[model samples]
Target: MVFSLFSFEKIQKQNTTNIPVSVIICAKNEAENIKENLPLVLEQNYPQFEVVLINDASSDDTLEVFESFSEKNKTIKIVDVKNNEAFWGNKKYALTLGIKAASHEHLLFTDADCKPKSSLWIQKMSQHFSSQKSLILGYGAYKKKKNSFLNLLIRFETFLTALQYFSYAKAGSPYMGVGRNLAYTKTLFYEANGFIEHMKVRSGDDDLFVNQVGSKKNISASVYPQSFTVSEPETTFKNWINQKRRHISTAKYYKKSHQYALGLFFTVNVLFYILAILLLSILFQWMYVLGIIGIKYVIQTIVYYNAAKKLKEKDTIYALPILEVSLILSQLVIVFSNMISKPTHWK
Candidate 1:
């Protein structure tokens, strides 16, 4: 029997144990975020951890911000890119440097714009390290919001995507991991060649790496609330769409099997919706339209509710279908635009 992309097996929950972790952050012009968010990294409750802040030639006040943080927090080391390198490009280089400077056998990674939801974030991630392992998958969420329809829209989009990936993982179809709060075995990273395959691409270092490794018994997920990191969302739809698009285009480089899995999903949902509308239109009945929307949302509510409950994405998952339909439309637009222009910065 062929391995199913959507399988029933999952990364069984195991007790993670004593192992030191080295946290890495790659930043460029992230001064505002660094000041507001970097302290959380320094103050994490985890005892045996070091943070390496790789300044990738930021032309802004990022250097000054790091210098201030470094003075107060000795655990924070500012590693600057040297002119010695004859060839270097985007963030992958900066991340490689951060990984090199990391001290622990296990590496926990997050962005400067992210903050731990709870103090135990480091403890939760490090536990997956076990006695001797090279990789651990973790989860991250968007910051909470109660005002503005836009904020709700953004949260809904983020929360739902989280459901699709993580819930899919729960069903045994783990594809990629998020960099905002991902951990890996330092040794395994080097052994896998460290982003060599997708180095030139602006994104996918996190997702593609996991795609390469696939699901082994060693891969683990953290369910504790304190372990998750929450990142600031792009305030505007245009900005969020651009950032998401760049990430999506990198999907083209995904492993064949993984690619087929995602394709199956997108194709299924889109085609199903289209077919439902066409078939029901032929009936020309209001009840059919209502039934279609109602049933879809019902299924969505179940999957998303389970996802939200598991991922700590709040109760927003119930609102997924409405958000998901819009998400699918926006995804199409962004993915199409990014085909011509590769977006680099998160506006």
Candidate 2:
């Protein structure tokens, strides 16, 4: 987290740049979201870009919404996908068709339920691409709701996850990137054979693809708020936990080095709290334990404060300690729950 705070840099948007990009959005029953959010995508300030809307066998009016937009906007291209028995509930197959339909080499991806924080999102994300760098990782934030504990918890977890991935990418060990605001070239997607390696796993259309193709030299982290995408947080605890279960189940497919690094960090934090609580209950080495815990909190607060400001989630700073503890406990429950039963399909 500290490393990301100091090392993360924003890419300057170029004037008179002509890199054509295809903004791909795959929706499964996202009619309401597409109606509300797709205009912002269609109205982006980039010079050359097309919007590829993939109606992934949506049962709702999602395809109708796409047609409504495509009728008026010439740049909007719609691909209607049917349910194939071979890849019935697989998001990967839908995304592959969308990628193939994209008219440009550079592609930016976001969820149907997400909207860019700034119109310069395309310019900001695509600016980092060069001869060496193909993957651009942007932070995905959750919308804040007043007087909602779950909303705050969701935002804090998103903030911390960004800190870890951004810090790791900055430290030359790129691990994962969120699809809510991630971008890459069409050439790289095909070169890596896309998501074929993990197509059966419904949840990793974003991170697992990054884990397979991301390298120290080819991936860049974008910390600018102009590049951010915001999505609605799950409204209920049960829904959020199920959503997390699907995501956490993908961790096992990550490279071994990343598994160890991420696992060690999580294990150390979980143990830190466990040991602190045990020692406090027993009143064993009371003063020393309190001092160490105090020091850790102080450092964590400082790091999280700076990171929150950069990511535009500073509202979460006041409840950092509480949110961290709650998130840790929730993640433990999610891991155990996934072990007992596999996570559900992507949708």
Candidate 3:
């Protein structure tokens, strides 16, 4: 089957003199990550852009690291939020401050733990913005470590998430974007009131805000290799599960249409495997059951391989079958966990 829905047109570089970009990053006790990743953002090849780092009450040497960078690089701006009882563990507030501090109209956002895939990251991402488009969604991939089941599963899950969001954006029904490599105009944030409604929630700094303000006509995507950002994956299963739980909590706040769409997708995915297993158990229909399963697998492999290639995740194609099963289990666990408890920390 042809996967035209996930196909993306490459973005050509354009003269960006009139469109200076501001890159915002929110860091909380990310001293080590900042030491390694901040320079990549500061050294971007874009002509006119500033890096705004929000040092959100880092007890570690994160503030010192930001100060060290600011001393040499004039483009580096810092907003240090001191440890306050009122603003403890709130990334949305930090991000809002960073946006307000941004000097340029076009704003790009990424986390302190993420590094751009190329020096031309800003230039590539900014090219998608025009007079009409206000939002730009880019791909954020995790670094591929040693060949292992957990690593492959993580990469596969990331690829599938990108596939759904990117395909939906291409289909003109944009729903969400990852904050690790997402960009939008400062005007869009201000006009949308800047996450005021979901301030109480720990997460939703990225997906929730986009769901509220994004539309088919206003949002564009940048899937070019140069525009992507890469970040370190959670090394332990406990950390990864917690991260997924925090992310799942934000789904409840999505628009009704988006909720329905994602819900139907997950439901169909779970049911597909369940029915396949049941049909395989019936000896009389073994041949037909195996054929059906084979056909579905072939289609998935083709679509996923192409999508993975475009996103620079080609190595993950080999693990699609196992990853798909693990994804269903992960989804079920996250759904059940969210029902019992909500994530309290944004970190």
Q: Which one wins on lDDT?
A: 2
Per-residue lDDT tens digits for candidate 1, residues 19-42, read 677888888789999989887788
Residues 238-328 of candidate 3: C-alpha lDDT, one tens digit per residue: 7888888888888888989889999988898889988988878866869988898889888788777878888988888887778788888
Q: Model 3, which residues run further than 4 Å from truth?
A: 1-3, 8-18, 83-86
RMSD of 2: 1.8
Residue 132 alpha-carbon offset, candidate 2, angstroms? 1.4
C-alpha local distance difference test of each model? 0.73, 0.88, 0.86
lDDT of 2 at 265: 87
TM-score of 3: 0.95
For candidate 3, the lDDT comes to 0.86
Off by over 4 Å in 2: 1-16
Candidate 1's displacement at residue 178, Å, is 1.0
Clashes of 2: 0
C-alpha displacement of 146 in model 3, angstroms?
2.0
Error of 3 at 241 (Å): 0.7
